[model samples]
Target: MSDTHLLICGNSFNDVDRDRLSTAYPAVYVDAPADMAALESGLRASMRAVAFKGHTPFGAEAMDLFPQLGLIANYGVGYDAIDVGAASARGIAVTNTPDVLSDDVADLAVALMITQARTMIRGHAHVASGRWATEGEIPLNRKVSGSTVGIVGLGRIGREIADRLAAFKMDIHYTSRSEKETPGWTYHNDVVSLAGAVDFLVVALVGGPDTKGQVSREAIAALGPRGVVVNISRGSTIDEGALLDALEAGNIAGAALDVFENEPNPDPRFLKLSNVVLQPHQGSGTVETRTAMAELQLANVAAFLEGRDLLTQVN
Candidate 1:
């Protein structure tokens, strides 16, 4: 057996991938864990860098169990669920597939804008529930063209969204950590002011402790009654309760969400509202994107085994 033992705390590994792992390391796969305790037990017994599927979190305590863990190759781009600082403290490198998912996520963001703006959900519910005739012609939803679009956290995905929206003749404005010098776009130093400035506030920021509650109640309120909020980023970036309250009060026009704080199990309260559009974190769920993500993850693992630097190290 190879000295580099590998363990995966996630869904079924690709059969080909599993067979490949068997060639080099003692690969283990666990599914539908009852609790973290079971996962902890598995990690403690393993002496290798562990891979996690979905949103399995590897915090300080979890990291402590694997002394020989050289790296954590997370399955997704966002490391919100993982404790990067904790992993670094233990001299473990954390890698995420970032650029691979940016365009996919940006596509979802624009799709959200189109879906919510066109009231696609309202029309769909009408037809599905057999109430289309009774509803008597679905009302017109908001328009996307030539609208002021404000992007929060103007990173790779945000920039992509901006580029796509420009084709619609929409005015672009953004708020980031610092002012970016992109030509033909307005930059706002204050997110609250930026929220108030645009017809649609599109969120494409990363989610983690730092970005937790970044979109505050005050910011949401600033968006005004006619403003639409679109979140293609992590849900933790927005205050869920505050968002619900804004939707209830009609403070903001509507929202299109592709991700949530409690994913796979989003707040049930959001489902009750017709003004909100929800997607099950499928921003990067495309076959092409997912395959790319897995390939990158495998490359990261292979590089580590060869004593090479990670392709997309989070640190």
Candidate 2:
């Protein structure tokens, strides 16, 4: 029997990525955190590292199951699903694949902003469904170029998004822990002010307790019915209830979301709206970025197993 030192948790891994990890280490695979408890005592004891890849909560209880777990190598940039405090308390290191996916996520955010602003989906449908030929012409939508955009977080991904929009001649405004050194870009101390100042608000804040609902009802209201929101970050960073309310009542212009509070099955109310642009959480879904993420995750797993320094250790 192969050694079970590495356990691959979560069902989101593609076949190639799974094969790469399993080939690199003696591994066991489980679909979710709950399945870890079903393994035999000896096997659980053998798990030294976990390559986690899903949004499922891997908390203290789940960590306790693997008594020998030394590392939790999360697959994506956001390690919000894993309980870092619990892992730290248990002497387990945590690593995440961050910068590799930043460009892809940033690209998606920009694409979403442009798509919603210009109504690309509707335009495509108009041509594909023969509506343009029959009805004469589709309505002209808003232009993205030369518009004002506010980025909620000036992190790696956030900066990338701002840089892309800046190329389009946009006036960039951002809010972060502290002001960055970028010249000409306005810095807001609060999200409400940021939303009020820009035509498009992009959320790139990290997901965690500190940031949950950081974009509140007041912030959404401050957008003043002319602003659009583009979120490529985790669903927890924004107040989904407030965003939905704004969309439904036309309090804000619309939203282009790559993440949601309840994913795979978002709120049914979103289905009824035509202004919103919804995505299936595919921020880093490109083949190149995902392959890079998997490689980073595997590198972290190997580093932990071989007693080397972790590449992107968070805790």
Candidate 3:
């Protein structure tokens, strides 16, 4: 295959994604980790970098398949799916497409907040189905302006969401790894306290073992009956069962979710809940942002091939 040193792993890559990357630098392609083993021995040994584009885990076993592999350029901001520790142990560099998609994800977080609070989806259905004409005016929805909001993580995406909310006259509160210098915003020592203090709770924590279930059952309980929870971060960041129990029992006002523990197959219970708003994890799915992300991923691969530092190396 032209002695190509690059390997692109992505079962999800469409014709456009494949063509765009393949055209930039000729490379071998594999849909999944298992398929990598099927490559010719010479071709496998020549691979110096991998451009990974899916949620599939790339562990040490997979890394071993490429003896000369030096880098793994992840397609998205979150690399929880890849075993970074395994890559590091094998001296493989890891890079992710960050800042490029932050604005899109952050914008989606804000959109979910507004959509949930205002019942915009229901309003659309009400109008489209002619219910507004027959049943009279739709019921009033909650106001987001001037509301108190608590962000679970004050990282890049979280900060963006908070900044936009500031324009809505929101009182922003957040709990981060370390408190930031933003003077007007309140900082909480823990999530329970943060949840109890706000009318809406937005989760923006990264996905990994360190943050797994950071938003605990107690935290969910603390949000109270009037609290609306919004999660745009990884699903594993929160306790799914606890959140569902709280929602079903009306322990919390409602929830607006863009990610789930099971992803495309989230709990069937969520499908039946009218109080919750659900999205198909399209936080960074915009054409402009996705194009930027792809370009960033390719840039990292190119850097590794050319003996240059990765633009956004994770490890």
**Judged by lDDT, which candidate is best?**
2
Writing each residue's lDDT as its tens digit, candidate 3 over 1-315 gives 646988989887767777778898879899987788899988998899998987777788889988999999899999998899999999999999988898999898998999999999999999999999899987898999999999999999999999999999999999999999998999999999999999999999999889999999999999999999999999999999999999999999999999999978999999999998999999999889888988899899888888887899998
**What is candidate 3's TM-score against the reference?**
0.98
Candidate 3: where are CA atoms >4 Å away? none
Q: What does the lDDT read for residue 71 in candidate 1?
A: 80
Query: Candidate 2's residue-wise lDDT over 1-315, tens digit each?
Result: 337799999998889999999999889999999898998888898889999999889999999998888999999999999999999999999999999999999999999999999898898999999989889877778988998999999999999999999999999999999999999999999999999999999999999899999999999999988999999998888988889999999999999999988989998988899997889999999899999999999999998899899999998
Output candidate 1 Cα RMSD: 2.8
Candidate 1: Cα lDDT at 178: 88
Candidate 1: global Cα-lDDT?
A: 0.82
User: How many clashing pairs does model 2 include?
Assistant: 0
Off by over 4 Å in 2: none
Between candidates 1 and 3, the one scoring higher on lDDT is 3
